[model samples]
Target: MRRLSTIIALFISLSAFADEGMWMLGNLNKQSRQTMKELGLKFPADKIYNPKKTSLTDAVVSFGGFCSGVVVSNDGLVFTNHHCGFSAIQQHSTLQNDYLQDGFVARTHEEELPNPELFVRFLLRTENVTPRVLKAITPGMTEQDRQAITDSIMYAIQDEIYAKDTTLVAVVDPYYGGNEFWLSVYRDYTDVRLVFAPPSSIGKFGWDTDNWVWPRHTGDFSVFRIYAGKDNKPADYSPENVPYHPPYVVPISLAGYKEGTFSMTLGYPGTTERYLSSFGIEEMMNGMNQSMIDVRGVKQAIWKREMERSDAIRIKYASKYDESSNYWKNSTGTNKVIRQQKILERRREMEATLFRWIQDTPAERENLLHLFSSLELNYKARREAGRAMAYFGESFMNGPELVQLALEILNFDYEAEEKMVMSRMKKLLDKYANLDLALDKEVFTAMIKEYRSQVDSLYYPDFYATITDEYNGSDHAFIDSLYAQTKITTPLGLKLFFEQDSTYNIFEDPAISLSIDLLVKMFDIHQVIQEPSTNIERDERLFNAAIRRMYANRNFYPDANSTMRLSFGTVRGYTPFDGAEYDYYTTTRGIIEKAKAHAGDRDFTLEPEVLDFLSSRDYGKYANTDGDMSVCFISNNDITGGNSGSAMFNANGELLGLAFDGNWEAMGSDFIYEPDLQRCIGVDVRYMLFVMEKLGKADHLIKELNLR
Candidate 1:
């Protein structure tokens, strides 16, 4: 293993270049500033991030920590992706009032609907405190000891910051794999409301078929308003709360941009493993990604049937389906791009160069050799465990709603669990109408079959033996029996079970028993895999430190960890194939063409009113010079999952579009950035405005943006 590691590391070469980094907002050094200037940035670096003054960073916010949004008006009107607000929209939709089917536009502030548990956070400032953190570590400290000390120091910093201002949330984030750390402060606003959202036909145009594909026409934009107390501080949802007055609001630009234009994006990008080793990449491609794709494909197949059959089911399952399908398609695309781009092979070559560099430098060689060897050995050792975890996660955790409900019942106190279960049951039945027992049973059976086939029997739950012996190795029989025997499958049965004061043995329930067994097996496997890796974290920190030193001359940005970041690039197009070239911008023509192609399909069908606007070509002021309404545009900006609702600004720092998706060819960007091929897909601000004004007749929203 050591010999193989050394050989592979000896051939590694660094390939960081172009607009390929999610740069820290507080650490825009001289080199990064120069790069941004060269890319056509007109504003000074201080204008982008100023603690004492309102800057561009103040306008960008973390939308519920999972996506990004921008403050577009002084009254805190937030702009984000429709999919980011999907769950809230679904919550408000029903057969009589289906906002997901027919678009919704809040004509007045009073008309807007409040979303429960929704929040947006504005970044106050970011400060580097690596020195203070590392001061707590001693030379002879073990990895666990170092972690404990680090956590203590981090808590101390957070406490100190919080003591100064209780409203501000202070978080110390580790970067460069724990070699560095930054302290970020944010003010969270919880009283967010839905202002506007186009129907699924426009917001989710092409649906699963066109999710990650380029030349997209999906509007993908939603508007929400953040409300605060009379004092203008963060507050819970109340009628007394007023619209928040933001420090900065992005100025909308009606002048549409073209190819080669300078573009910048700011958002909280979720995660990226750009420095992952070849072995890790191999495992992701062959194990994790493939498992996700296969399992989600089976689950979605079951859901689609139920959703298509009933409008109520469609609303209940819409958000769930979208969440599952998004990553499923992403996994499929990542696998394809990884293979097409030879990403694993390239990583191996890069590792070889790093090993050669380390050997040449004796200081680094002695320090990092063991780290490299450990990485290789650890990955090999944990492959089976990782695969097992993936199977377990997909099967039990993400498979059916029933499994999760069962797990909840098993884990919580009886009285508290009863109340929670009763509340959930009432909500599911009242809001979603009914939980489809047949569909869930089918899903459970399918998932179990896949889990049994993919994961080793050694890691399998004991319930599998019951299924095999008692049910004659039949997943169908096992699932049918479980559902038939469990009262939790029915609303009345759950209510009656909760109402009864008699002590109930949750372990006797088939579903709860199965879930508990699965949980135990998963935890046991995880422990077995992690028990041997006592020094892995320390070794990784050292390894990352060495890499940073080796590439000291080049600019290094930490991997995305749901922190605010800025990425800059040019509006560019690519020839994904030998003879086919993709244009940088897509127009209304593509939407019409898609609608015509799939006339009766709900995913592709457009509302008659929207189609009429497209046919008339009366774009008003939203049309580009060619007299065509631009829908979506592509750029080479580096982004990932959490950047879904990020604002795309032009050279002058004016809002041009909302970054929503990454092209399918760029799906592997989380691992390796292909500057020429990777593209960020954004819905044009003009299209959003057009949808608001012409289709939804949201004049109030248009005025709120204060368009220039």
Candidate 2:
């Protein structure tokens, strides 16, 4: 039954709802004519502005990968994903000051601690590169040729600009296969600092278990400031540098919109998989979700155990634990929904209808479907074997060591990349090797024994080879001699060797290097080895067929990823799966209620003096009684991860709220936008003001806001 269930899940893996398409933006077609007309969302091409609509480009910045943010201040004061800001917060954390667990706010400019690795991107310009780009390439071009042409054109464009603006970078992005192109110029700043954040209790109120599940009480938002040169240009860390002062910052309106008001979320959205094949959905539903669930479940257990016994581990893995727990819940929830199958069936029907309508020949359709199918099959073939890469997957954890090794290699004139690879091997060897020969042999033998006992033989071939070779080799005396010469014995001895030896090379020794080489070879083999070409061909045919069909309908576009897209919707409310309806409201009262619940909980423990203000409902000091909106509310705006810190604006261009999260119902927006299910949650400007005035007791900060 367990095996059967696992097989069933593999077929359901592609159930991404919110992942691939234009979020919930496709509902523009299905929107009631009355609602659409009321929203006045039919902004024509002339009025619509790209990032550089005017002197002030909507600061398009990526806060690593989990989320995105926008610059609300001209002088580089940016807003972005709360989750995105997590790493920065974590980086700044120390034993004495747990910034991740406790929120941080730097009241003064000098008070703000510079986050060395944090970066913000300014979208300088974007242009259609299709004509110039495609001129050098053609339809029958191979992927290699297409990439070469694309890279050449991109380099040419960027090189020209790089000469003018050394701070800026030009990236060429592809759209509609190889037919269309967008060349974008970005000004990047590395010196960023934390501005203000609610405690984890408030910022991530519901924590990971609540992520991607709507009716969410989690306040998933954060703010950051980008510092630049005194002349308003991007700059590195400098005490002399100042906050960027832009010509325009969004003006916050006290008069919040009611239901049916026109609203839009404008910011970078990371990725979408709306164009994925049904088989792809099955993979996500079964494979990705299940894998994530299993991993996160283990992580959560570790976190739970550590949270109770080890403060150090809790501190170290605060963000990781939160993420794992959240993903576990989210994946499980998503898996559950996919298993329901109604949504998948609906999506399949839509795909079928699209296929029937597209003017593609049977051959073309077959080719597309084959493409998608091949991808799925390949993924499955590599699925379990890919676990070898997991231990070294995170760029954040691995990047610094690689960077140091690259610098060392640079000293010897070796390529930085090659040095980094050597550094990786060095680390791996250190992990498995020992310092004292007898103990080393014992440790290595025991470790290999564990590997043999635990890890699947199919995955850990190199480790398996160690145990097998010890027994099978005729040179038992040679093995004893080698073991005696070996330095490593106990785990601590091996660790000490790595710590003390600065000039060890895993690649220099034949036995060690060969073993290391085998690991790498197997890792690669696991990553790429797949079913025979016949299955691959069939999958591609399936994908091409699906795309042709989807294109035929033209009812929905493939989901946009990290691509600029405009989503239109209205301020509204939604009913949750549990039959509870959320009104377009959240108030200061809710904040106080949450605060009182955690009288001393890190998220809510207000200073004793502040409690008096809440009791008095001294809202007059902070609350915009005019609209009386709770600090947070809902709007029917289609958005995703990239839309963090997006300014939610009214028709007259007044900022109403900061776009944060989509209601739980809209989690499916990742794959397919269901208008009825999609609603954007935001922190109203009024609530922001109230928090600043009443709770924060920093009414002085209000002056910086462009309040009308």
Candidate 3:
């Protein structure tokens, strides 16, 4: 039924030298291995990934399913990005013992804080399941039918594996668009605990101001321990659990990197759309990104201003603010680079090449041309609806904390009265667990105002009508009144929300009613774009297949889909613009200078003792050969969002640092990789050891690591 697999090998990258692919670890061919060796990797290919025996694959962890982590000690010590573990650090904090502000250190095993629901999954293996997945599609099948069939097959596969082993979970993910599928199985250990963390001054030194910037000084690393049952198998949290012994735990290399030192990163990168057509790129730039930027710009402004005045608010909302601002700046940088690089024009040029390459096959060529036309038309037809949807998402689903509670309740299945009401109350309790209500009200007002101003009434909730009718069109006054009058806001109403009463009509509450209406309207917009979005998804897959045919001579790596991927390149710097060359690495000197530059800024102002220690020339065994302490470094290794906290290793497969970010100029790397401009920013291993040793005084933890 016309799977693109028959047309061409669905390639995921441009060329070998660009180091542009989030290469599948299990799928590395001989040519890929040769290329890696040429770049700098010293290990034999099989040594890195062998299912029969434990290898480097066992050392990496799917950090909380969102970010990446690596096993440092055989005792299950997992090292991940501080930002990755930010929520857990914040969760254990209190006004009396503010872990977010003071940072955390567990000298003994019992001191390590247990985080509920936090998990680390080890990749069991990845298998190509394209034929099995594609068999679900039939001629004349609707997108809905195609999806339902595929989902059932995938669920069956996962269910079979789960029935065999309770610890194992399986996922079938589509890659190279939907042209290919891969099944990945993992062993999830649920007893992960926070071990060590540096103060915000160290962990998140530059804050949002330096988030995506290069020459980064932030340590950006956190430590956790994975606890397993008596047999070293996955288990729920228990006092009897012991540290897990990994199959392989690479040593930390004290000898630092040269400008051209070889490096590699193995992690799960969430997503990348390197094969998107010109029309899709333009649609995202003009509609989706703009709406996201506009909506978040308002929410973050209010949230950030309030966070500055109050430490309690800052601790409560730091993670939320970081999450919102991250993509806000990402969309900002994405649009900027697209304009500066003329990315849309470049994509059209590539498509033109594909159009000419298949001129000999009239039938195939016509189909290719029709695919392009459909993509352009589809993107154009759904432009306004897509923009409205983005606004709705950024405003309600993400902007207001109450909306999160509302959506959670709407999705949960409450069978009995007591269970339903008690569950609802649990949600209420958790809402205040991490969120500050006063700040939420501030955010709610700003978000609703911006959403109303930017989007049409067609995309808004029925509550907008109430605002116009009962509140005289004043969003500020309406939101304020809603918060003041909503039953959920009152203690009695909250108690009732948790009480054993199935008669509680959650929809009768103003906040819940408004949230439901907004969500319902958002779903309406979603329906309007569904057809075109489905068409785009299908056509994009075919387009990439066509691209593989046009560039059949070049080697390709599959696009990342939150699976284990390996990429290697040299530690190198770049020239962001003419006459401006950035060094490959930054030292503690840069940190001190930045701290001085933004002296009064909370983002840059470090604790006086931290700054004094850096300036005191206490560079000991961990110092770089140049006599300055290395803070962070950059490499050309391919990585993306979920690769945060991935292990960055040297030629000998020894740990060098933790991959935490990519330079700002290459924000569009997700869409198109420019090897010349792109760089993976990592926290040097020595700095992490230094922080743990000097600041945390956790020498016992350092002694556990195999330091070279």
Better of 1 and 2 by TM-score: 1
In model 1, pairs of residues that clash are 9-352, 10-352, 11-352, 11-353, 12-349, 12-350, 12-351, 12-352, 12-353, 13-350
The model with the greater lDDT, 1 or 2, is 1
lDDT of 2 by residue, 1-708 (tens): 854554344233323222123422212344232344466654332233445354323544556534556556554566555676876776667668887665677788888888765677656667777788778775555555666777798789879888997888887776543345677777777778887665565566655444564444445556677777888777777899898765456666666667777776656676655545565566566555665565445435544665556555556556655555655665676666555535566556555544443335675554343443446567677555443333222111121122222223223322358645555545444333211233223323333333333335554544246535765632344345444443332354344444645554534433443345444655564445334323543344345445544445433443556755555577777776576777776764665676666565553455455446445665663455563435567776767766766666676666677777665555555555566666778766665556556555555456666676
lDDT of each residue in 250-272, candidate 3, tens digit only:
78899999998989899989887
Task: Give the alpha carbon lDDT tens digit for every residue of 81-150 in model 1.
Answer: 9999998898889899999988799988999999756899999999999999999688788777888888
RMSD of each: 3.4, 8.2, 3.9
Give the Cα lDDT of each candidate: 0.85, 0.56, 0.84
Error of 2 at 249 (Å): 1.2
How does residue 560 of candidate 2 score in lDDT? 58
The top-ranked prediction according to TM-score is 3
Residue-level error in angstroms, candidate 3, position 248: 1.5
